[model samples]
Target: MRTLIPTLLFFVLASHCHGQVERDKALHFLGGNLFGLAGAGIAKQASDGNRIWTFVGSVAGSTLIGLAKETVDAGQRENGWDNDDLAATVLGGVTIGVTIDLFSKKDDKRRLRGRYSKLDLKKKKQFLQPTSEFVVLEGKLPSLNTLGLSNQQFVVE
Candidate 1:
């Protein structure tokens, strides 16, 4: 019974330590996400929506920060190195980039719709009207603008 008690105590202690380590890893991952998101936001504001600059700043900043953390942990000799943390940082940055791209696409669609809404029927027709130059279609080629069907539903073989 005495030996059993000691074994149980040891197991409980080990589980507690394991839980603490997992919690610490979670915190680090979340911290990386926040840092990467901030970097992305700052880059977007600074570069005025330039995708290349935003991506570079966000991913590089987060990755560098993660590497720095690993370096510090290495010096401490306790946590050693964690590749998962670095991967999480990169994933966070990519998430931000994808989010920004989605927003940009949404804005583009809105602007296009608004522009089209402002145009009258005559203007809409005029916009799709092709030039007077006629070209002969000898081959079975699909041409959307050839039959005044630009932006309209048409079948293509």
Candidate 2:
């Protein structure tokens, strides 16, 4: 619930959003989103969870790809370079980068770590101790008398 605000704000504040919802622009946005997400993941791994590097990587990757795409389009006769498309792409990248940054709080990590530590201790204690009341009987079935049901009747087909 708390994370939804930034996402909604990003869509509202995206650049060059002049009520022109073309398929080409949508595709550019999607492509930028994929590239940005990939970049953020790679950067997070390379930087060992550095927040700034992850955001930079996402924006940089999307911008680079958007530029390359526009350059290619400029070379073609039918599809010329469109600034709006590039803006959409960059916006997608920024959206993802900001989302990652917001979610990756150090305090959240610390809280999770503390919770997991307690859980780990409990798990270790459970594994190290054994209950004497429970017994394992492999390949053998308990008779009615052993089960404390001596008066029970059984029918076999």
Clashes of 2: 0
lDDT of 2: 0.76
Model 1 over residues 51-151: C-alpha lDDT tens digits? 66666667766777888888887888557777877776667666665665555533442321112123243333534766686566786654778666774
Per-candidate TM equals: 0.48, 0.56
Candidate 1, poorest ten consecutive residues by summed lDDT: 110-119
Error of 1 at 100 (Å): 2.6
Give the top-scoring candidate (lDDT).
Answer: 2
lDDT of 2 by residue, 80-150 (tens): 99999999999889888898777655554431111211223223343457656744478676666776885
Write down the lDDT of every candidate, Cα atoms only: 0.64, 0.76
